[model samples]
Target: MQKLQFEALRRIGLTLAVAQELIHLLEQHPGCIPVRVTEVHRETVRLDDGTQDLPARRMPSLARGLADQDDAVAVGDWGLARCDAHGDWWLTHCLQPFSALVRRDGDGLRHIVVSNVDTALLVMGLDLDFSLRRIERFLALVQASGVRPVVVLSKPDLCADMPRALAQLQARLPADVPHVVLDGRNAAAAEVLAPWLAPAQTLVLLGSSGAGKSTLANTLMGHAVQETGATREGDGRGRHTTTSRSLHRLPGGACLIDTPGVRTLRPDASEASLAASFNDVARLSLQCRFRDCQHRGEPGCAVREGVDGDRLNNFHKLQREMRRDTLTALERRQQLSEWKARGRAGRANLRAKRGE
Candidate 1:
């Protein structure tokens, strides 16, 4: 009976690793039941117990324990819930996600977009929504989370010069990361994206508004599961038709999560992740004359010679942002003071050199 119950859970994206972890948790908590968090509200969360969806509230102790964490509970997270005497389910504990898509907000807080994602289908519209720099940012985020990323070039029909656009993307993107071009509204998307839609695998669609993430989800599911919207004629930017992140079961047995368009995507990555994402620049930096070459007009700078100017600039920008985010309040103030001191000293040295 337990095996049959687990088989049903497998249809909803329960893997061997997660099942093992749940078994351990069940051993610890005798009466608690394993549930997948489908949706999270302000005070309650909706969980799927493989058979049905139920509203569950977080225990006060559990909420307090995760108060300092980046997110209390994200979509696709598994948790252990227990029912009270009144028959209302209360989420007791949220299991740590094996993988998570996280991004840093402007306020320096980490925001988890989704959890336990196996593959990230980075949906970028081939129209006005296409940008290689933004895709690189997404790659960094996905790579840092230990999730596989496949670039999905959506709305290929809307592109004026499809060949040129694809050529530019291939030139900038990493060769190992697979990219596919297809119309999301067509039924053929399922066939085009079949390799990653295998049973028990979980995929998430991430892109800006009007990128056709929802449309692709519907096509893959063979029905209108998510609502679709039109993009602005002037800017080609789509409205936020999908407000919340939610998971859907595909006909192929894989789970798909659709998220709303993100306006600002600051990558929550480490230095190693940044280096791996921009491997080309990182490799070239080793050939520079100076070991710590900034690649800013420095003599014998191989990064500047080998890498594209714009891509190199974007790498430097992300590096700076990551450094700033990791700094403490006191460290930031001290760094500002040091910069002021250096500026004053540089001005004095100029006066001395000019005999002023």
Candidate 2:
């Protein structure tokens, strides 16, 4: 392993331990080089091999192993790149990520948003785009990925009452979670997010369109690296200025992955994350009368008595949603299995009939 290679990779969010591991893994396969994926596109991906960015595509061997060929790459992923006999580069293999942030499609299929992210900057504009419910949804998603959530209330300069808005939003979040209010376009905004932008840390910005995610990315990078668009005057909803997820290095010595504005985010989170995101409600539930108290009409329902009525309702609603999703997924799997079994039986019966 060359010292320069390791140092350059480290500056781009590769840990020393992971670099050594990649080196060892590559040693077994001669002529293969280590590279980190910086941007993922429909047909090709851009990788940084600790020296320069290289555009490559997945090899046929690599594509065959993926359930969806399009899922062959994502931002913040580490992969092995090898030049074919034709001198063209191909991503040979992707390293298993230590962590990944995923969300569900309308049909409930999971999709990777970003990988190897340590922190999630959950941005919400303090204008018409602000909603505690939306924040909770984002929190559940981030918590599920085991990523630290930092609530960033953007465009506070536009808010009529920044302090009041900040306090109200903070009241709804977990007390331990860190948050900051700032104007995403201001240069001072970068300083407010400095703690999470330390060397080698990879942070992702998540928020609705026009929520200032792209602006924040540009401000943090200390340049106009990301395209910024104006939000609708009526609703304050911004258009999708960022069409793709790309990883950019920040002046603060960290990697920042900015995603396109997501209008809706349905979390396919675990029960633990659900409870953690709604810690207050979860705590009240523990004090309820029965171990399985629904808290709707149960006697001695601490959740009903102590928690805010709307928040409690939202919590219950999310619980029901997760349960429904789990059941739906199971039923879908079972239906597929039954269909396969019936087809097999039908073929078997046809063979028996022919024999008769």
Candidate 3:
């Protein structure tokens, strides 16, 4: 069946295997139907392409799987959906993600915002929203996703003290990662992003709303494909402009997925990602007297002695957050196991009552 599907897809002009993977992913949903993703909206995904066999159709599907839901793949993910002969569409399953930016949602579930991305552009406006701690959160999430993360500081014109802001950013970020502070509204700035914007690569723009993600995306695509809005004056926060997760193909052969503004991001991180994100801290900690030194009031603690008190304090804060995330995940897992065990016990009691 898979071979035939591939052969059929080949007959059409769509030479990519991505759509096929998407179809397979959605097939896991028992009642889903195959639909081609032409465009996506905040609530519904527009499906009407030559690849789809259904009658010229555009129907509403649940955004539930796309939001704050565990095992739910985000935009840029291909899945097999169950949309029957009646034109109803239900997402059945998601394809295995090559890469994704995931964070813990309100329900304590891992939410995938963007998936199968080659690059994650961590957008931060050079204006008020710029903070090293916030950037660290994003870096933690990106590191957890196992994808390359590039930082782009937007709205350079708004910053009165550009040098100071840049200094702070530079101080927190490692020397190896690429970081750019650019005017999202400018064409020349788009050219500076050309290397990652090359053909065939897929990148996602992520930041708080009004960070100029949509603006940067539009500039790169050489067209106003997304809506743009001014930043809020009341608190210097950005109003939600790009309310949907949508994918666009650039003339340069790259693809970009613009996502809604994320207000709060929980670090659903792994130990490896935490270590990688805070490698400096890790390196310093290794020099401590005890192998398991907590670096707090421990005699001959090299980490405590060598690093600045403020910098060490920040590292410890990040460490505490990482540990908290791990504990939370463990607690959730334990509760789930307990619930399942109770269910099993109840089933056993019922079976015995039935005289097995």
Write model 2 residue lDDT over 1-356, tens digit each, in one string.
22327667877799866776787777776678888899888789888886688989887787777645446467998878888788788998888787889887766667888999999999999889988888888898899888999999998767898778877777788998999988998898888988898999999999999999998898888888788889999989899899999988876679999999887777878788899999988888889889999889889999888877877777777776676566676787886799999999999999999995
Give the poorly placed runs of model 3, Cα more than 4 Å off.
1-43, 47-69, 81-93, 305-314, 328-356
Stronger candidate by TM-score (2 vs 3): 2
RMSD of 2: 8.9
Clashing pairs in 2: none
lDDT of 3 by residue, 272-293 (tens): 7877776776788888888988
**The best candidate in terms of TM-score:** 1
Q: For this target, which candidate reaches the highest lDDT against the unseen true structure? A: 1
TM of each candidate vs. truth: 0.92, 0.88, 0.73
Q: Write the per-residue lDDT of candidate 1 for residues 112-140, one digit (tens) a residue.
A: 88999999999999989998899999998
* Model 3: per-residue Cα lDDT at residue 75: 64
Q: After superposition, how far is residue 260 of candidate 3 from its true place, in Å?
A: 2.0
**CA lDDT of each prediction against the hidden true structure:** 0.89, 0.84, 0.69
What's the residue-level lDDT of 160 in candidate 1?
Answer: 96
Error at 309, model 3, angstroms? 5.0
Model 1 per-residue lDDT at 67: 83
